[model samples]
Target chain A: MSDHHKETFISKYVFSLDHKMIAKQFLITGMFMGIIGMLMSIMFRLQLSNPGESFAVLEWFLGSKWAPGGILDPNMYLSLVTMHGTILVFWVLTAGLTGTFANFLIPLQIGARDMASGFMNMLSYWFFFAATIILLCSLFVETGPASAGWTIYPPLSALPQAIPGSGLGQDLWLVSIALFIVSSLLGGLNYIVTILNLRTKGMSMSRLPLTMWAILITAILGVLSFPVLLAAALLLIFDRSFGTSFYLSDIIIGGEALHHTGGSPVLFEHLFWFLGHPEVYIILLPSLGIVSEVMSVNTRKPIFGYKAMVGAMLAIAFLSFIVWGHHMFITGMDPFLGSVFTFTTLLIAIPSAVKVFNYLATLWKGSIRFTPAMLFTIGFVSTFITGGLTGLILGDSALDINVHDTYFVVGHFHIVMGLSAIYGMFSGVYHWFPKMYGRMMNKKLGYLHFWVTFIAAYGVFFPMHFLGLAGLPRRYYTNSAFPMFDNLTDINSIITFFAIVGGLVQLVFVFNFFYSIFKGTKASENPWESNTLEWTTPVERIHGNWPGEIPTVHRWPYDYSKPGADKDFVMQTEPLKEGKTEH
Target chain B: MSTSKNNTSKQLLWIAMAGIFMFFAGLTSAVIVRSAEHGWDSIDMPIWFWYSTAAIILSSLLLIIAKWQVKKGNSPSIYVLGALALGLFFGYCQVKGWDQLTAMGMYFVGEGSNPSSSFLYVITFAHLVHVIGGLVALIITSVKSLQSKYTKDNYLGIELVSIYWHFLDVLWVYLFVFLLYSVK
Candidate 1:
């Protein structure tokens, strides 16, 4: 390794080969993208609540082109929704969540000096940076950003003349996504290799922290599934650019029949959902891993059923691939095939239930810390359960036929995957803040942020279920067109109010995070008294994690409050006693 | 580098190979799905694709010999150079195959194109892109071998290149057979 002392500002801060630095880069970029995505949501919610009413803030952000007279153009509403989902799902949650934690925690918890290849890690960040720029640039194009939904389903995405937002903006969206896939592949390859090969001598697979296992599995999931997305995107690109009829057929646009024939948009759906479903697990699993560790440390107990947690993760990962067809049940698929997908989809609830029960058992009859991180962990479980129950209703093809594209589906996923994953991410940030910056965040601000966010999140999404059940379809610019939806206006206003509140609460988190980075009290090495190897590292950041030899792991990472231990927590580096057995 | 670091590179290569395999798998499945539709036009297997397959297999053989020479503590420059030459020849044959495809009136796009023919073109071009990646690796390995940078104790670069080369060869053969039989 090069001498850390000789590093210049550009080398240290900009293009540094350190894993920690690369992780911080992912965090900052992900948060910036998250802010953009949230603002887009707020803008769309404003349109949804008032439906053609003027909002000066909309005019300010979108200008006269998209939000003329402060009323968001219908095309821009779809653009904001598309960009919001694309940015949050892919950029913020997938790359941001996995990229940050995987890069930060893999080497530290596994007791390695660095990733298997630091140069590739740096390349991963740059590719993501480039992809981010391209996606952002799409917004400035005359056509506006891609408005064909985040899925970019064919017929609409394939034909530029089909929609006003389909011109250069869709092309940029595809290019950005392709580049993002490359970035993730590079990052995933590094994470998998480092964890498999670079663990210190005594660290076995079973002995690894849950975070490492989750990341390793998530990386594998990415490697296997992302390439399929690349294939899908490549065909879509060919269709869009080269006049190939892969995903378009029987289309009469502008009173003219183009030559496209014999292609099925259902093929694109099949290809997309193959990656899309596993992508849900990809976003949620890392948070699950982080929450597991944080819950164990805060509750002062060994994580309930360590092997079961790992098993459930593996089961969920495997089942994710098969359950994708459930998303396509309403696409005129065969009833028998839909039944098969439904069966597989319901099977996922078994493992999910196992994980939830294990978390509850871990928190039962324990010395709970109720720290900001723990509060978020508990909040994650609550939303996970609330949102997951609705999944059962949505998973059934018969029931799903009623609420397939309704706000019910939106409400369900936001609470389950979106809210749960974000909660997990916040919990991880609060827990690891001291480790990342060597400064403590304000606990008071954290508590306030958690309470408001938790309440406001539920307040926003919970009402959407009722709206969806009342036949209020999603992706509609306004409900004013139909007199049937007139009664739901009050409910819409209430949801938007909570959404604005929820959006504002994140600023508290942002202020606390940035302020604490420089001005918060200096944190000790092991502020949380966790058993993981990361807490054993020095408070001051260094090139390699440990100053001297890497410590050898002697036990599993969940050894909290063991009988007759010197302290409440036992670091993984501590050896077993003479008569004690390895747990 | 330590043994584990070496293992890390090898493992990374294998995982990358798996990813590439999945990419092809996805494309081939699309071909199956799309061909089941009406108006599907199946093009004949081009003669040059057969020639390209043979060239890639020969290139893999030369790479294997070069790896053996490294084990015997001899300069593997000749063998590595032979492998690189054959890889270039293989790439040349692929372009010729595409020409043959066009000559047979199978267009990847435009007025004459069909989805089946387009799938064939896209799948083969994607495979060719990967072969080009392998060729770059081979070129670097050959240069290093000519400078005697690889020894019996440290030939990881050569091994990685050879592994990728062999996988590419196998991949082409499988794709060749699958396309020939499955395009109908």
Candidate 2:
């Protein structure tokens, strides 16, 4: 494992087994997917904001069949919305957030040479790469991509003749998803094995950083829950391709009755949400973990209530499984079952509250540095609280009956899980760029990116709650379909305007990220003056992580401003003095 | 140090097995719930399935013997080949069983079928797929054992394949019992 090997281009960049290179691949691919997803949202927002108005920009991107005479076809509108949700949820948030950070940080923070099985790690990325290609290929098919929404509920998804997009497009979507599941399982297993077995000497489970704990739990959740989604996908595949009635039921289309019978669509919902609810936590916990580390470093204090934070995360993971029924409360589930779900869903708030309070406690009365990472961490806390409070209303079976499938549900999830997670990701990129690339992002550009994104995010979603309250249903191509909804047209326009602005602001980050990698200020080994083991590595990336033997951990990662310490932060590799006790 | 690494790899295999178990648990639960609904008509179990079940059980017994023989510092290829042959035969019998069902007009899809028989076809087909994966592993281990790659003190590959083969054998038994009681 020497650093002086004559590495070729393919082994170094294209198909390397190094965790750092693989992590960069995930980040860049995720960013590419995020751009596509964001552009789709902006396209649909234009159609929503101005119902019948034709824009040449739409014609340029979508071409004649979809946006003839510049007006978006109604079916294509649904297609954009569906692909947007699917790509962002699965490809961007799930893969991008977890894949990028987990692969990057797991070995560095845990003091491992590499993943326990590097070959499997390489296989995982290729699976994800193939899945991405297959999914993108679906867009070029004659009928368009899977348009039954990101959930791809059956009857619509199972019966090809039901919608034009249900033909080859949906088949490709299922194949892509099945491939993605395989990739995730492979990656998740590798993370678990590496964390469980490959920690450096003295890095016990308790001494492990919060980021490692979050990733470990996230991997466990993925291993258990993703298989259920695979089963759901397989059954849907059987119904669609093999003509089995696993999810299809008695239906009449085009004056003909379908052969499918005795099967329940509710069953598909049951299976999908079983993976779907934990998926929210899966998307959020990594950011939550990153925010904890960033907040401690920037505030010059130890993370408040570290044990309680870990306990809260574990509690949230356990509670995520039982609370999925809340998503189906309005679908005529058993009222008793709904009540049980509502209780479990609301009980999650206790752990969530503990985490938020601990974050605020860490920031209180401390000498806080307002780095871009810290600002984004604060933004995450804000959106997490705001979005989370709305869940209480939606979780109540009685209240959810009114807001189900409305803009209110959309607003709640986007703000809490969507924006909060994205902010956490931004915080991580800004904080860890130095470690990853040995360069610093421009702070002024970082500040500009943060404020605009923060303000515009709230500007876009905050008003959607009122529209939901006004009884406007989601997935409507035009609010003009109902005269009663005509009054809220102005609000839709405002939301769309802010969404476009927010979407454009992301380009600043894109520019900053690429520009900083090549030309930004050079960073020292410990630029953030953090206590974590990752910063202890030299600025240059290496194969086995260290030129010599890996460093041993003598204390926990979050030892900021400890009493009797010479400096404000003590590196985890520092040895304990004769008289001082380890924090 | 090498022994600890071997243990960790084995532990990873078990964790993966648990995940596979949850997958089947989900599908089986769906079958029971789907069966309870209206318009559900039950079909008779094909006799070939019973033979396939016995073949898989014997395959598991052969693998156990192979494991025992290897640990005793003896050549285990005879038992390994015996298990692999039975495993392939079990797969052939499963295809024959499906063909028999189709002959008897119990379709997995289309007008002649009920959801109950469809569940039978699906659950069995999924298990057969995993069994195929086990067969591939068995074949590789058989080659390694013939080359004397494994020793009495280091038979991790043999042990992993045997453990996985037996798990598949046990899984098929559970699915068979479930289908027997539930599929009329």
Candidate 3:
């Protein structure tokens, strides 16, 4: 509105106030980091499966320090694993997933002109970019990236000489994390304020889409939890730089006694897990919400229980905070308290069960249209169920003692957080690709990508469950080192085979992504005959979303197959009478 | 919606402020709990901290008076200068308190002594760091007032800055009293 039309390149892309442009920036950045994180995993998997084997490409990539004569060094292996976890969790999953979708959808779906504070929104993206730069710079440091692990456990992280990565790498890791926390806080504040204050005339809280609900609650979780991580990181920085003992004690760095005393690493574990476990849910809930919207529209039916779905999301979020102790059950905590944590963790299954059943019920006996987005939604539900069943096993204290650091834990999270959330991301991209690009993605190519990814994801992670059950520990660089793991060698190799295929299948997505951007078939305004308000906007991207006036919400987002509606699905802006509004 | 944007923006600003307050709140909790633990040794605190608390409280009153003077077109520079002096005095008081602890032979990460003294130092130092940020904001407001950038009709910046300043003023007093009365 204020002479934004003739902006320069830097103002247009780098520091754009346009929400869609901001979303595009986040998407591209996230994809770049995702490629990095995924490639790191593949490299590690090669080491895990082959065990001491290397290629010329490996040497060319690593140089002499990490791969001497094409052989993988142990410290480099650990550092790569650490960096993989760091990039995927912070930059890719949290920032990429929430950052991209929240920027695009918050203003559009809520029918506002833009976010509540445009300056803050732009600041959030720039802070995230700065954090990404700091993290990448730390990799070029002489000591390598943080190798104390992504959690950066103390005693090792507290004392400088405990490991090579703890020297400069750990310091850089904390700095990156601190910057990232600031970025998330800024974005979270904007999201919450916009949702609370800037909804259009008739968009009641209950009438909002599931995506808005997830974003709002997820922002709340970010607001309350990220600051705690900031506090922990600050204390850790003090321990590292300023000589505080908040989480350091009984230490000997280079065989010299540390000046620290009476500090408990368990306290650090408590603080870290306080943010850590809820962070897992924070990364997944957006995907789950996206799946709901996609599924309802694709199935040509209303979501089975709209109020119940919102309730489940809220319940999951609240339970997420109180159950952070699940991650600390094996960290020398009281066994009695483990029972309490296990109880709360298992109680989460109730709301999760409600969501699962609601999805199934909505898909029951409906004229289901299996679009690219629909395929991803179904993939999410399947993987969520498979991953969730294992969570029950891990949540039990007696069982957890055996599987705490086993490959079983890896399998559980990859299926849930890794595969399921990735599916959610893909579903969103496919669903909104038309709205975003004014074009349609190739349906045949999308189906191919989905099936290969879905089958291969399960093929890759499911065998790790059997390996964990066979008493194999995780984070071991080589499986052949222990004769006890010899039988599991075949299983690990099989998983790698699937993983390589799955990783390669992503190339199809890469091709589709670039090809569709410029050459895909042009689409109509509402390409997918869905009932959400986003489809009602123009096909081409507009500066502030709608053409002139914002739309007024009249019903809940899912209004498919109503008794007297003209079409199978009805737009949210279509006014309905009082008694007819009940689902 | 336009009608309530101001209120909502203020609410959001408070939410951000609440995050900052809760961060410090967690630190205070850690300090209190650590002192109650075994092996904590108490250190001698300065008398100047109590005097600084009183100074900050007086500054809060002066800040309120300046807010009133904005509408009345009254001479508020004296109160503004008074609040700045008190805030500086508070910072100087903290530095002197650190010296007092040093003179008493307490050290951060000290060898073979109670760690409670170190906790005291860290708590005070962390709070002082944040207080310095608040002081800088107040200083900017003072500069803008001197240049006549604010008036009764458009003093939202002054109002918000003073509100934050007063919040920090009361926060420091509470921490001072809590530390003196109950710490160690």
TM-score of predicted chain B versus true chain B for each candidate: 0.97, 0.97, 0.87
Q: Chain A TM-score of each model, in the order shown?
A: 0.99, 0.99, 0.97
Best by DockQ: 1
Clashing pairs in 3: none
lDDT of 1 at A551: 93
lDDT of 1 by residue, B108-176 (tens): 888888898888899999998998899899889888888899999999999999999999999999999
Q: Compared to the true structure, candidate 3 yields what TM-score?
A: 0.94
| C-alpha TM-score for every candidate | 0.99, 0.98, 0.94
Best-first order by TM-score: 1, 2, 3
Please identify model 2 stretches exceeding 4 Å from their true place: A1-4
- Candidate 2 vs candidate 3: the TM-score winner is 2
Better of 1 and 3 by TM-score: 1
Given candidate 1, what's the lDDT at residue A81? 97
Among the numbered candidates, top TM-score falls to 1
